[model samples]
Target: MVASIKSAGKLSESSIRSQDDLEKVVEQEQPKKKWRWRVDTSDAPKEIFNRTLYLSILVFGVLGSARGYDEGNISGTLAQVSFKKTFGLSDPHKSKDEVANLKSNIAAMVQLGSIGGSLLAMYTVDRLGRIRALQQVCIIWIIAAIIQITSKNVGQLYAGRLIEGFAIGQTTTIGPLYTAEVAPPQIRGMCGCIFAGAVYFGIMMGYFANYGTALHMLNTSQVQWIAPTSIKIVLAGLIFIGSFLLCVESPRWLVKVGKVELAAQNLSKIRHLPPDHPYIVGEVADINELIAIEQEAISGSGVFDKIREILTVKSVRYRFFAVATMSQLLGQWSGANAVTIYSPELMGFAGYKGVERLKMTAVLGVVKFISAYASAFFIIDFLGRRKALYTGITLQMISILFFAIFVTVVPNATEDVPLPLTASEDRAAKAALASLYLSGVGWTMGFNSIQYLLGSEIFPLRIRSFAQSAIMVLHFANQYGNSKALPKMLLSMHKFGAFYFFVGIMAISLFWAWFFVPEVAGRSLESMEDIFSLPWYMIGRKGAELCPDHSEVSKIHVNSSGHGNAYDGKLDYDEKTSVHHDEGNSLMVKDSNEKDLEKEVKK
Candidate 1:
C-alpha cells in the first residue's frame, strides 16, 4: 500500500509495505551533507536548537552557582582579619595547632552537611519530581544563608554552613541529571558542560565578592564577611524564581511515571516539533521500549529489587563502579577541590601575602571559568570525552609535579607567616604559582567538566536518581576528607609531600580512564545500553565499532493510511523484537512473516 508521511507541514508519498521499505524511506529523508561547526550535528534537526531549550538549560545551569559561591567565598572569608578576631582565631592563648583544627572544622562543615544532603536527595528526587526537589533545595539554601549572615558567634556560623551544605549536595545531584534528560543527543555534551561551567562561574563571582568586600569594607566590622556570605541568598532566590517561570519537568521522568501523553507534549515543546513528527514519535517510542525492557529484565518494582539488579547485572554494575563511583572519587582526590577551598592559603604558601593573595585567587577563578567554557565550546564535543580526559589529566599531572619540585627545593617556613626568600627562591615561588593556575586550567578542561556529564548520562532511568545520589554522597565525602586533611597534610606530610601524593593519584587516574572510560560524546541516553553491552574489557576501546547508532537498530514505520501514526520497531538484548505504538493512537501490526528481519545485524 502507498504511504503518505507528513513532516514539517510537507507530505510525501511512498510505498512502505515491509520493514525494509520503511528503512529506505527514512534514510532518504535524512540530510545527505554533514554539517560541521566545531562539532557535527548532522543527525540533529535544526529545530532542536530552539530558544526554549537554551533558556531551560540556562535556568537549570545556574543551580550550580550555589556550590561555586560557597567554595569560592568561604576560603577568603575565613582569611579576613575581622573574621578571625570574631571567631576566636585571633586568641593569643590558642596554639597554632589548635587554630588549625578550628579552621579545618569551620571550612569542612558544609561538606559534612552535604553528605546528609546527598542521602536525602536519594529519597526526595524520585518521590518528588526534579523541579520540586530543586525548589526545596533553594528554600533551604536561603534559610541557611540568612543564618550565616546573622551569625554572632562561631557555633552559629558552623550551623549555617552545615545547613547550606544540604542544598549544595542536592543541586549537584539534580542539576546535571535534569540537563542531560532535556538536552538533544547532538548537543548533550555541550549542555552538560554548562553545569560544570556554572560551577566555575559561581566560584568567580564568590572570589570577586570577597575581593570587593575586603577591598572596600572595613576590616574590623563583621560586614566584611557578612556581605560576601549574602551572595548565596541572592543566587538561591534567583534560581527558585526561575524554576517556576522558565523551567519545565523532565520528559524522561514523565514517561517513567506512566504519563505518556504529558511526556510527548513536553518533549515536543523542548524539541520544537509537532507531536506526530517522526523525530518526536521515534524518541518517545525509544524511551518506552527501553523502560519496558529494563522492567522485564529485573521483574520486580521494589527498591531492593533495583539495588539487587544493579549489583547482579554486569553492565549496570560496571556503569556504577567504573563510570559513576570512580569519577567522583578520583575527581575529588585530584587535589583541585583543595586548591579551590584553600586558594588564599595556597597563595600564602607560594609567598603572596594579604590582599595580593586575594587578587591572585580572583585571577585563579577567572582562569578556571574561562577554561571550563572553552572546553564546552571547543574541546569537549570536538575531541570527544576520552581524549579530553587524556589531555586535561596530563596537563594536571605536569603542573602538580612541577609545583611539588619547586616547594621541595624551597620550603615555606610557615603558611601563616611569609618568610624572606633568596633571589633564586623568589623565581621558584612565582613559577610555582603559575603551575597552580595551569593545574586549574587542566582540571576544568578534563575531570571537572566530564565527571558531571558522565555520571548523569551513563545510568538507566529506573535507578538514575539512586545511583546519582550515591555518587554525590561519595563526592561530598571525599571533598570533606580533603578539605579537613589538607592543612594537616601540608604540615605533617611537608609542603611537597601532599602534592606528591596528588601527583601519584593523578597518574593512576589517567591510566584508569584510558582502559575503562568509553567515548559517549554523540550517543543518545537510550542507546547507552548498546555501548555497555559489549565485553567489559572492550567497551573503552571497541564500543563505537561494535555498536551501531540507534537509528540503524530501531526503525520507525509510518502508517500507509496517513493518520500520522508511527510504529516503533526495536531490538532488545536477547534479540527479541518489541513494537511500541506512538501515543497509543495506532493499531499494532503483525510481522509474523518477517520475524528475523527485526534482529540487528551483528558485526
Candidate 2:
C-alpha cells in the first residue's frame, strides 16, 4: 500500500519530493508490515521465529536424531557382530545369569552416563550457551565412538556406551530447549517434537544401517565397524560444525549473560528484523523486562538466597515437580525403552531365532518412526497435549496388558507357536510381533514424545535448564531401575509377569497424568509463569485452548456456570482513579491495587 500524499494549493514539486524522501526514511526506520499490527501483552502468542530460527531448530533436530539413533541402534544390531563375541558372550549356552548380568551392565552403563551428564547439564547449560554446549558434546560423542570402535574388551565397550549415553543426556536436554526457544508459536509444538521424531527416524536409520550391514557381513570385518558407526561420527562432526557455522545461538541465553547488544543483534537476525524493525524493538524490550525481573529476583541475595528465590517461585516449583515426576514415572513405566533396549532379547524369548529377530527389530523401528512422524504432525495440535497423552498412554497400557495376557494364556496353551516369515502371515508369532509394533507406536505417540515436550514447557525461563536437567536425572533413574531389574524380574517371574509389572506402572502413570499433568499445548513458553499460578484444573483446561489469541490482552469473565468467557481487552490500572475500566467498559476493578487482591480472589 502506498501512502497518500496530500498537496495543498501552494505545494512545490521539490517540497513534495522532499516529503516523500522523509516518509521513505521513516518507513526504513520501522519494521515493514503489510498492515499495522499490535500485540496485546497479556495474551499474545510468542513472536514467530524467522528463517534463521527454523534452520537452527532443524539442525539441532537432525543432531538429536543422530544421538537417539546411537542410543537404540546398539541394542538391536548387537546380534550380528562380534559385539557379542567381542564382549565375550559368543556362546548361547552360557549361564543365563552371566548373560543377563552383562546385558544389564551395558544397559545400566548408559543410564550411569546419563546421570552424570544430566547432573552436569543442570549447572553448565545456563553458563554455557545451549548451542555451544551441544557442540562440545558432539566432540564427546566422537571420542566415545572412537573408544567403542577400538575396544578390545567388553569393559571398554561399555565405557564407550556410558560416555555416549552421557552425551545423549545433554543432547536430550538442550536440543528440545533450543528448538522450543527458537520456534515460532504457530509451530512450537511440532518443533518440540522434532527431536523425538528425529530420534525415531534415527532409530529407523540405525536399524536399517545395522540390518544391511549384517546382511552384507560388514561388522564381521574390523573395517566395517568403522564404517557403520562412522555414519554417526560423520553426522556428529557435521552437527558440531553446523552448530558453530549455521546455528543461531539463543537470544534468550545471550540476554541472560548480560550481552544485551549481542542479544539484540542476534534477535534481529533470528527474527529477520530490519535494523530498526518493530520486532527488534519489542524483542529488545522483552529482553530488558526479563533481565529486570531476573535482577530483582536475585538482587542483594547470596547463593542460598538465590536458590531460595528459585525454589520459592511457584512457576519454578510446579514445573520442576511436574517435569521431574512425570519423566520418572513415564521413563520407568512406559515400557517402550525396555522393549527398545532389549528388543532382540525379547524377540528371542518369543521364539524368534537368528537374523529374524534383527529383521523384526528393523520392522519395529520403522513403525516407531512412522508413528512418531504422524504424531508430530497431528496429535499435539488436534488432540491437545493432555488428551493425546491420555489416549496414547491408555493404548500403551492396553498393548502391554495384551502382551502380558498372551504370554500367560495363549503361549502356554501351544507347545510351539507358528512363526510367520512375512507380515502378511496370520501366525501367532507375527501377531505377537504386530503387538510389539503397536506398543512402540503407542509409546512414540504418547510417552516418549510427550515427556520431552512437557519437560520443556513446564519450566519458566529462569530455571528451564535446571528443571529439565532435574527431570532428565529422574528419567534416567527410572531407566536405570528397569535395566538393572527387569531382566532379573523376567528370569524369576516369567515374561508375562515382567510385562505385568510394566502394566501396573503404566496404570499409575496414566492416573497421575490424568489428574496432575497440566496441559501446555498452545501456551507460549513465557506464559508458563501465568500457568503455574493457576489452580491445577484451570491449568490443564487453559492448556487445551487453541492458541488463545495471545496477541492482545484477554479480558475474562468468571462465569456463574463455571466455564469462563474471555475477550480481548486492556486491563487499565489507573492509580489515581478509584475505578479501572476494561476495554469493553467493564468495571474490572474499583481500586488500582484491587488487581493484586483479585489474584487472591481468583485463587
Candidate 3:
C-alpha cells in the first residue's frame, strides 16, 4: 500500500520522503519478540481505581452472600429434629434407605432447576443484556423464596428449592462475568474474588439464620422451616433493586453490538476518567481491536455459521470443551457437594447428631467462608490463579482421603444407634470432623472460586456469554448428579467409598489441569481471543500471542457482525497490500476460522 501511494503534487518531494521515513522509523522501533501483555494495575496511581468501581463489584459480590445463605441454611434445616418430624422424612414406616433417597431428592432438586436456569442464561445474557438478565433472575429468586416460606407439603418445598436453584445458577454465571468485564485488567481478579467471598459470606449467613430459626422457634410448626427460607427473599429483594440502579451494562458488550461511542462513555464511567483520557482511549482501542480480530474469524457469516465452526473445528471444540465443560467436571467430581450438603449425615458417620451435628455443620461453613475470604483477598492473584487452584486441589485430595479413612477405620456407633458417642468415639469423630473441615477449606481456597474466575477469563467477547452459560450448564448438571447420588452412594456403597470415587476423580483432574489449564493471569480480557484461537497443542504452554499495537490494529476492519472470514495479510505489516494478490488458491479466509489459522498452516 505504501509503495502504491500516488501523489497529486500538492506537496514537495521532501514531504513525501518524510512520510516513507516515518513508516521505517516505526518498523525499526518494533520489538523483536512477542509474549503475553501484562497489565499491572496494582502499581497504578490510587486514582486509577476509584470508589465507583469498588462499589459496583462489591454490590455484585453481595449477590454471592445470598447464594451462600441458601446453601448453608439447608444443612442446619436438615438437622432440625422437629423439621424432620413435620415432614415425615424419618417416619418409622419408611425404611432407613427410603429416607435417605427422599433426602437426596430434596437436596438435588434445586440443581435440576439450576440446569434449566443456566441454559436460559446463555440466551438471555446475550440477547437481553447482563443487567436485565440479573434483574429477571432476582425476581425469580424472590418468588421461589415465597413458595418455600408458604410450602404446605414436601412437594411444594421441592418445587420452591428447584425454582430458587434455577435463579442461583444464572446469578453464579452472570455476576462474576459482569464484574470481570467492567473492571480494569489490573484489578479484575480482585473484583471477581469478592463474589467468591460473598458466596462464603452467604454460607455463613445461612448457617446462622438456620441455627437462629431452630433456636427461637424450637416448638413452632411452620416457623422452623419458614424463617430460614425467608432469608433468601430479603437478599433477592436487594439484588432486584440494585441490579438496575447500581449496575452498569458491560462496555465490551456495547462495543460488540456496535454502540462504540456509548461503550466509551460507559468505560469512562467505570474508569472515573473522561472519554478522551489516555487510559480510556487505550482500553476502548483494545476492545475494538479484539472485536476486529474476532470479526475476521467469522467474517460475512451469520451467527449460526460461527456456531457450526466452533462445533466442527477439532481444535476449537477441544478448547471450548476443556473450559466450558471439563473445568466444571473437575470441580463437581471432587465430592464437594456430597460432603457439604449432608453435613449431618456425614457427622453421623462420626457419631455427632442433633444440636451437635448442626453446630459442627455451621462450624464447617465458617471454615469454608474464612478460607474463601483469605484466598480470594490475598492468595488468588498473589499465587496466580492456576498455581493456587492446582495446589489447593492437591490439598483437598489429601484431606478428603484422610476423612474417608477416619470414617472407614474408626466407625461411628451412631451409624447403628442414635445414642451419644462414647468419650473415645467423640474424640475420633472430632478428628474426622477436622479432616472434613480441612477438605472444605482446601476446596474453597482453589476450585471454589476459580471455576467462576476462569470461566470469566477463558472466552472472547463475542461468544463469552454463550461459553460461560455452557460452562454453568455443565456446572449445574454435575451438582445435580452429585446431590442425587451422594446419599445413595453413602447408604449402599458406604460413605467412605464415595470419598474414594472423588479421590480417583481428583487424581485424574490433576492431569487434566496440567494439559489444558493455560496461564492467563494478568492478561487483558481483550487478549483472551488470541488464547482461545490457538491450535490444540500450543495451549497450556504459551497462551494466545499478542497482536499488533493500537495504530496498526485500527487498520483492520470489523466485519458487519464483528467476525470476518477473510485475511488479506494486510494486518501482518510485513506484507505489501495488493488488491489482486493470491495465496495459492486465492480461497484463503473462505472458511470461518481460517483467519487465525493462516499463520499456523503457512508454517
Predicted structure with the largest lDDT when compared to the true one: 1
| TM-score of every candidate relative to the true structure | 0.88, 0.78, 0.81
RMSD for each of the candidates = 6.4, 11.7, 10.1
Candidates, ranked, lDDT: 1, 3, 2
lDDT of 2: 0.66
Model 1 lDDT per residue over 142-217, tens place: 9999999898899999999999999999988899999999998777888988999999999999899889888998
Ranking by TM-score: 1, 3, 2
lDDT agreement with native, every candidate: 0.82, 0.66, 0.70
lDDT of 2 by residue, 359-413 (tens): 8888888899889878877777556677777787788888878777766754542
- Total clashes in model 2, counting residue pairs 3 or more apart in sequence or in different chains: 6
Best by TM-score: 1
Error of 2 at 332 (Å): 3.2
* Candidate 1, backbone clash total: 0
Residues 1-603, candidate 3, lDDT per residue (tens digit)? 233121111223444446656355334433343433333343232454887777777777787775677778777777676668776785899997788788778777777888888888877777777788888888999999898878778989899998988888887778888888987655677678788878878877777777677667765566877777787888888878876677767888888888888888887787786665434565676777678777876654445764776687564576578755776888898987677777767776777756667777778888988898788766776667777778888989998888787767765453667456677767877788888888888888778868788878767677777777777888888988888888778777766788888899889878877777777665677666556567666676555333322232122222222223333321222112322221211222323343233222222
